[model samples]
Target: MRSLQPSRDVRIASASGAITDLPENLAELAKNANVDFIIGDWMSEYNMTTRGSQKVTNTDEAAFEQQFVDSLTVALPDLAKRKIKLAVNAGASDTKRLHNKTLELVKGAGLHLTVAWIEGDEVLDIVEACKKEGQRFRNITTGQFLSDWEYEPIYAQCYLGCFGIAEALKQGADIVVCGRVADAAPTMGAAAYWHGWSRNSYAQLAHSLIAGHLIECSYYVTGGNFTGFKSLPQSSDGTGLLNLPMARVREDGTFFIEAHEIPGRGGEVSVNTCRTQLLYELQGKRYYNSDVVAILDQIKIEEGDGRNSVYVYNVGFEKPPPTTKVGLTAFGGYQAEIHYFLVGLDIEEKAALLENQLRQYLKGNFSLLKFTTSGTSTSNPVSQDAATVDLRIFAQSKSRNDLSDANFLKPCFNMVMSTYPGATFAVDARQALPKPFNEYFVTILPQSLLNHTAHIPALDKSVRVDAPTDTVPYTFEQDIELTVDPIDLFSLGPTVIAPLGYVVHARSGDKGSDCNVGFYVRNEDEYPWLKSLLSIERIKELLQNDYNGKRIERFELPNICAVHFLLKDHLDRGVASSSTYDVLGKNVAEYLRAKHVQIPKKFLDRGRI
Candidate 1:
């Protein structure tokens, strides 16, 4: 495969539009950004599930996508004139229109969609195939099938690896548009593509993931959370942008992230902003990187001579645990809630009486999902001494259940009115409160798991970016390759202990025959035992026990805290494949329970926190 081309002096600029469409501010910000690919993230449910109910479709993100795109589209020619690139994930869930227009520009208009994570429409078909093979799981919220809907997503990219974005550039795509991808994908892809980094080099990959992580959230790195970062130039404006300036440092003992732009409009350059980003979520001894784990203990950052620029070096890494996969969704509903406090001299009696009183008023077709009292915990008790009792009333049913806000309203009203009459108490006549739908997210795993009963040919038409490879062939010591395939994404696995759940999502790495598996796990919970289990040594054991591959090979998993592993060449095409990892048994409910401890009300009240 051709290596990514070098565009070392590449400078990037971006724009962030004001909430009410402040094009000028956006334009100004754009001028200061000096970004290669301008990005806009507009999605109500972006951090939410990608595919779920039809009621809340990708269309939800459509309007914003259009707004941002139109903003860029309007400014495109000027950018083209200045030789600047524009891109955005603003298209969001329903990306058909964005995709169509982008194709028109790159293929017809001669503009580059400067983006990193772009999901091809073809992948959507992968989900259907999963269903046929029984790999697709169902997430009832949106009536969405579990497996990552490879094809349906107008934007279904988890995170863009380096290869593709660089490939697009080499193919002459000046402007690139992407679908749903990790916030950092675009920036990293751009850097690697511009740097001529080979796919095999872990260090560049590390740098790429690091750069991507910082810029991923536009202001997040710049100044969003620079707790003590005031070293570089500071922007006078309170917004993160207003700060002093400096030049940033990198692993090569050199400074990289720069805030330099046209004159002062480029704003302040500072080490503070960059430093905050570098140590944003530093862990003990080790800092996480996208490619190789970094031993933060060995890491260091420095600023420049008489100016703002921070430098990084000596970053180290740790072995990553297996990957886990989760899906995005939009579970829709309109709910009604009632909140009140039970008041009486007797605490337990007040609670019971409130429950009884409410039950009497609930005389309709709708069934209640929950009706309970609060201040019930023992360890961290909500002081109810002065208040007698506090109760919360709620119920949920299908829209077809034909229940309305009135069913809740009337019953709750009646409870207040008649409670004092029967129990002979006071303080009942007060207005009732209203609540919206008890929004819910029913998260399950492995959209589906199945054995291919038949062979399905590849459907490659518009784009021939031959499948990306994130799978790896694992062998313990000598030689053993487990179809010990990759982890499950949209689809849920048997045990919530989904062997590969940590991997957020992955695609083929390159044209290389080896499939590099990409695994992701939320960084907040880096379980020590599990982390230890995924040690490079253990992974070899797991891989060897499963597959018969080149034995005695170490694997790659970076940032076990936010663990994502890349398994290379572990799957077999056609009819010959088998592994405990590859064989899946589906049971949706049990899978959900594993994600959280199911404590009954009794357990919740009686057990310790």
Candidate 2:
């Protein structure tokens, strides 16, 4: 239980989680966090398509993330003054462009900074060549071949390892720009370079990878999107929502995530918060990265010695995966949506009337026409909002003209006077215009085929970083056993019907169209009940309509007392094209948490989660 020595710890802060994150975050962390390096993650599955399209169009001003350059403009002076290093995947589809932008920013500030960029993630042309050579380019989720894909492939980007980032930093790179390196690669690379960890340092690399994953989303580990946010302390401005986190990674690979206490920041880093993030967006116990495969079931998360700090350790690792995952972006088609409000009684009838009319009017005009209704009426309601419900009509088609026709809104407009009582449209005619959506495909390419390179502009040098020589082949379908002390629901003495969130804390996230929700209890005694209660069938039952005909996979983490369920192909085609209301699946956990269940009275005595 020794305190972390700032001199030895490879301190790093997550400057940005996504392209939409504020640019000032980099400056704030650099000016106050006193970290050795700062990292940012700027890519997502949807972004791969958008940025790739930008690149194809030669959109010079937006080929890369402008926010990242803006961030560097504000943080460059502070970073130079403090001699703090920086790394980011903000290059999106154009790493070279971002690299040049960084150099320009440094020169404009009259600062001496060695800027470097990592390349080899982009492989659109290679993938096309391989496809022509009979490489099926099979989809990982549905096992569908690329030939079966409806859209034409536009861009393909692979996930790279941390070696290139490490090599850049080793070659005196003050700023490292990257395109689609694994989300945690920057943190892993920084830790590896700081301790001179070898490529074969699987255990240490795995630990750092987990540490990187914990803080990669920035505010997530600090309290953002956390279920227990109500308990967090509010800032002077009366908002506890905005926050930032930094990690103190030891040479031994152990780390602690703490809120980077700036003057106006909010949020805390506790064991629960850390556990929530650790359980976010994972497929199972094994977290596969380009450099290492982390076995996460045995890991432990605990309260740290300092306030707003959570210690994480005990991670296991194996050699990296032989094939790296790749994302291909293609234009799905055009889509249009309209919302209608149905008030008070006969809500279902109102929705039914509109759906029937719309189906009659536009029956074969679109590829897909879907209707969804949510919200409930309270008995003896106090306000008009209480009795209001939402009915959404979503339509998608291969032909943009199909949805853009003036006749598209005619059915909606004609029914205004003939619709159910208290029915009203939520948007104007212009809001119903068609917008294009991208279809994202997940595949894999052999690591040996990639030419990962690290280039240092200041030194005029390029270092070739090869993929890992030692690797283990892995498949997500690998049999992972689940063992637990079974608790019979009927045998439990008495039960109180309440929302599952009363005794369980859960986190949910998306991967493509698939969603994973991990549920954990507050104490060990409640774990057995959690495991016994949340079966694959039970999860489908709780999900109700959303679980219709979709696959569900369940796994257990006995060490953390958690049960994880992966809902395959649940979000349609992910955030960009998903028709579901919970597009990113962020709300799936909350929705499941709200489902009432028969809970043991004994657990209720212990209080809410």
* Candidate with best TM-score: 2
Tens-digit lDDT string for candidate 1 (327-373): 33322233345556654455566556667876666654543345655
Summing lDDT over every window of 10 consecutive residues in candidate 2, give the lowest-scoring window: 1-10
Clashes of each: 121, 0
Top-lDDT structure, candidate number: 2
What stretches of model 2 exceed 4 Å from their correct place?
1-7, 241-243, 480-483, 490-492
- Candidate 2 residues 1-609, lDDT tens each? 122243598888999899877778999877877788999998887788888877876764557888888877988888988888999998888899889888988898999999999999999888988888899877766667889887888888999999899999888899999998999999999998888888888888999999999999988888888888877777766554566888888888898888778666577888888889998889777888999999887898888868988888999888898888898888888888778888888888889988887787764378888888889877788999999888878888887888875646656666768778877888575657888887888888888889899999789899998777788986756343444666788687799999999889999999877888999998988887889999877888999877758667777887788888878878887887788888888999999999999999999998776
**Worst 10-residue lDDT window, candidate 1:** 450-459
Cα lDDT for residue 582, model 1? 26
